[model samples]
Target: MGRAIVATAALSALLAVCGCTVQGTDADGKHHLPVRIELPGAKASPSATASTPGTPSAAPAANVLWSRGDSGSGVRELQARLRQADWLFDGPTGTYDDLTEQAVAGFQGKRGLPKTGETDKVTWQRLVKMTHEPGKWDLYLMGGQPAGAPDPRCLTGRVLCIDKTTRTLRWMIDGRTVSTMSVRFGAQYTPTRDGVFHVYWKARNWVSTLYNSPMPYAMFFSGGQAVHYSYDFSARGYAGGSHGCVNVRDEAAIASLFAQVRTGDKVVVHR
Candidate 1:
């Protein structure tokens, strides 16, 4: 009995030196020691799973962000956040229109996020960290204008550098944009021709021979391609396009451009 006790004590001491817990004896009186073997410099396993199926993750943080065709105060707030980052121009229109999508895309691209125009919770969280809270006017943007950087070619002398990507017409003289106007282009089926050309002719109060619509302050560049004020565009915003022309929405700005531009000035319609 003494020897048996010594043996059991020795076994218990050995188990203790092995860094095992004293789970006490089992039903049979056999030691039920549970050992958690760890390497010399290993981190401990978590007591429980950090995330479960329905549990929110650190990544994406939030769900149900914003996307196109979603119009509401939430979208306005999203736009306000983007505007604070300078990725969005103009005030909030309370609508997730093309402009807002483009701004979202720009912001995502800058931040190395997926360049989807939609605002997921991850996108929103990143933006929130970068920008401050929005004010009433910043969220609404009662009145503002959207503009873009001129094409590099527009920085040269006497170039009407029109960028289809930005939908902007820059009146560049001596490598400077003296005037800039928001413009739209033909639809997908009638994409404006991208090339360098000269304004071969000008016709004030010109009527479109093909469509029979009035084209005020028309400056013809390519074959039947003109830069002119579009009444339909003015009434419809970007909802309409010309047959194959650059449609300027601001009539007053185009009329002034018509006077300043010479018949033979350069017209660079680029992507």
Candidate 2:
């Protein structure tokens, strides 16, 4: 009995090393083991027939819709919806870059989905249910928006009618909108004052004495506040802000406005 036990122990160890499983008892009460002989250069099955103890289960295959490195109107709308849910900021840049990936992961994690950073069908459905359809302006928040109806104050005169809500500036000549362009404003702390003001001064090529920044085609309305061309705004889009100045990104538009707008032109900044 002792010898048989020792032989079974040794056989079990050998089979384990050779990648075989030992099991069952013979009719004579001896151990029976099955050994699999792997032929040289033979192709074995890729997956195991049965799972081992303590082994991790395989992750489910993702049903991907949109993922990183993707770009288009779809990604733009995704970003816009993410913004609506307050999960993203800085863009509807239309490219699923690092920020968009992180935002998607965060959203997935919050909703108890796998945090894979991919916009899978399940994730997309969940997000769609939570967010409303993004409008044209929402998708083009950083860029220009189609001009809404002119504000009551913007009507009737030569006016640089600035609407804070639309983030647009309309150059109106005798109540007719001659030109319109996208605009940006200051930060929350140093906000662009919302009231009726005027172009008290016009500087074609001026520099800020306080901040020492160039202010081209500057039309100063209130104290230190002007409607001017902003290189930063043009470069960074809506990601940056001005120092209490209304920033115009389009250089040619502002240059044209500078030519048309005389000193003491009406500048109405309203929400």
Candidate 3:
């Protein structure tokens, strides 16, 4: 009886071991115990989430800074900025000539700024904030005695008026009325003298012997008064401004006028 009990006990132990199945499969179609593995983020390891397709990446914003000075590059940059702001002047050539000075003064005056010809940090900042808006100004002509009819000397040409109120300059050209930038004039003592004259001559890189002023693309309209590039205080477009001269603040514009105008071209200046 004891021998039979021992054999039965051994057989029961073998059956229990055989009935315990493992999770893995083998080449012989037999199961085996699997190797233990701890999942990521299961208190054993850390992992990041994978990125998906069609996800947009954020872009950086534009960063703009203001600058100033008379360096060639800086001047060019300022000119470009002014042009972009619809200041329709000339390209910066690094020469702080009369035209550039005039344009700068005009720009400052239009913005209610102090009419200093020099550009400063505030000017740079203001220029950056400027926008391209169409400008208009009211002008008056003051030449020749007033009669019921147009004076014979009053040749068929347009008079340009620079309006201080609106900061714009308007004129008639080629039978078409047009407007441009606004500028300052001289004070009562040296107001832009009224006259009826003709473009008698043109001088590129012109130098004024009377005032020792250098005029770029000077177009003679009166005796000593001609339309030329200047940066004098007259850019304010006030009264009694010039020393018998019509000052323009844009060199490119003067160049344009030089290209189109000829001797005997009539110019009428009014109040």
Candidate 4:
């Protein structure tokens, strides 16, 4: 009996190493014990609900979407569309990085879709219709330049000259453009107001009283609208919106702008 017990334990250890399971040893009698084993490279029998012979088992992706970290032409196309909308600052790099995600989320918000920085079927379709199919140069940004012609109003004194057509914000000092950056506007409903305005307020770390969202480095120009840093803009890129305020994605740029801009600097938001 002692020999048998030692043999059983040793066999069990051996079976474990061999990837085999011992069964029906409830009574500890080796005579009635059963073992089930599967050899390497052997496959289990399919169930009745399995696919028919000669048919492909994997389903084609129907809801295929692109988000951050993915790479390919899809991401390139997404970047092009966003550039057309002035949401994507850089040219397409063929990889869906954080900037791509930001652009997608901003676009989604403008269209009143869920602010999930992903390129779903619906988002793709809408973007395709709205933006021109990008040429090779457009995607790669071989020669893309910011709008140079500032409005006459922006030529004198200190001014934040923003142009929707150019998709640029030119920081002007004494009739000369000092700085420029890619910018985006609000949705059709909550459009960033156009025309000349003045900075009425400045909040270094402002939270929206209405939207309950952060508006850091805010320089208020029109009513509740302000020029501020948006992490949504920074993280998601052009894929988000402000509540009628100018959304600057670059945190460092906005921080500098917030500091330099006075309480009544000229803000010209124009076409």
**Number of the top-ranking candidate, with TM-score as the measure:** 2
| Top lDDT model | 2
lDDT of 2 by residue, 1-271 (tens): 9999999889866765666544577899887765354434555443433345787545434478789999989999999999888899767878899999999999999999999999988999899999999887678767756667787887877899998888999999878999999999989888999999889998899999989999999999999999999998887677678899999989999999999998878889988
1-271 in candidate 4: lDDT tens per residue?
Answer: 9999999999877886675756764455555545555555665334422455888655434454887789877787788888888888875668898888888899989999888898889989999999898865466442223576999999888999998776678899988887787676786789999999998899999899999999899888988988887777665554455568888776787778778889889999999
Clashing pairs in 2: none
Which regions in candidate 3 have their CA more than 4 angstroms from the true location? 1-171, 233-241
Q: How high a TM-score does candidate 2 get?
A: 0.55
The estimated TM-scores of all candidates read 0.49, 0.55, 0.37, 0.52
Query: Which run of 10 residues does model 1 get worst, by summed lDDT?
Result: 137-146
Q: For model 2, give the RMSD to the true fold.
A: 14.8
RMSD of 4: 15.3
After TM-score superposition, the amount by which residue 257's alpha carbon in candidate 1 deviates from its true location, in angstroms, is 0.6
Go through the candidates in order and give each one's C-alpha lDDT. 0.79, 0.86, 0.53, 0.78
Query: Where does candidate 4 stray beyond 4 Å?
Result: 1-132, 135-145
Task: Sort the candidates on TM-score, descending order.
Answer: 2, 4, 1, 3
lDDT of 1 by residue, 1-271 (tens): 9999999999877765664545676888887754454444655455322355787644433455778899888898898888778887654778898988899888888889988998888888999999889865455344223456776776776989888666778899988778888787888888899988999999998998888999999999999989998887776555466788998877788888999999889999887
Ranking by lDDT: 2, 1, 4, 3
For 115-213, candidate 3 gives per-residue lDDT tens digits of 776677778788867743322111111111112222333334654433333323344454444435333444566665555666788898878797787
After aligning candidate 2 to the native by TM-score, how far in Å is the CA of 240 from where it should be?
1.6
Model 1 lDDT on a 0 to 1 scale: 0.79
